[model samples]
Target: MNILLENIKILAENENISISKLEKEIGSSQAVLSRAIAKNTDIQAKWVLKIAEKYPQYSCDWLLKKEGPMLREMTKNTDIYGLLEDGVENFKILTTSQKQIIESLQKVIFYLEKQDETGRQEKNKNN
Candidate 1:
């Protein structure tokens, strides 16, 4: 089976939907998907991107390269530390003052969140 077709089938199966239904959801026609898959031709990047754009649950790596799981593993939380790590990774392009400002903002945000939590706890206790 064509990898693109395989991924599309997998996506459709996972979503409890049909290929035609998936096509409708993505604003594509039946002829487009069937024609490409029937010929085993290379599918267009836009088609793959459309699936990824419409359904972010599908793994692009799996769809494009057959390298990963069909569905993307969902992150359990919005990891602030990982975001800070990403900022550090891009720190080379930042100026000293820019870095200082980001650090200050992070601290401010942290402090405000802590204060909010404490206030909530106090209110709950009073109630």
Candidate 2:
């Protein structure tokens, strides 16, 4: 139940949508959504259908059983890096600030990788 809610939160964040928006899209009130997520009551099958229809990118298996890939399909174009790049590009079309943030994050990731490599080399030297 908590796991289902957490996955919903993750999906909402990744899609740049608010929980309110998700609830509206699924034709459920926030209170009902909360109750369903908390397992206080069983979620209706219609609600599941609404979500599956709206967010086809989510793996049904993962959403229901947590036993498969998080995404519906496995493809180079659908990898996390590809999705992140697509998100940054979409944000770039809307605002320069988003582009700057993406650039900063790229630089931070580069620096972290370099630091990791350096640490590995130092460890090898000590060995």
User: For candidate 2, what is the lDDT?
Assistant: 0.61
Q: Estimate TM-scores for all models.
A: 0.54, 0.49
Worst 10 residues of 2 by lDDT: 92-101
Pull out the clashing pairs in model 1: none
TM-score of 2: 0.49
Give the backbone clash total of model 1. 0
Per-residue lDDT of model 1, residues 64-91, tens digit only: 5477676655442223344456776444
Candidate 1: deviation at residue 72, Å? Answer: 1.5
Model 2 residue 47 lDDT? 61
- For candidate 2, the per-residue lDDT at 107 reads 44
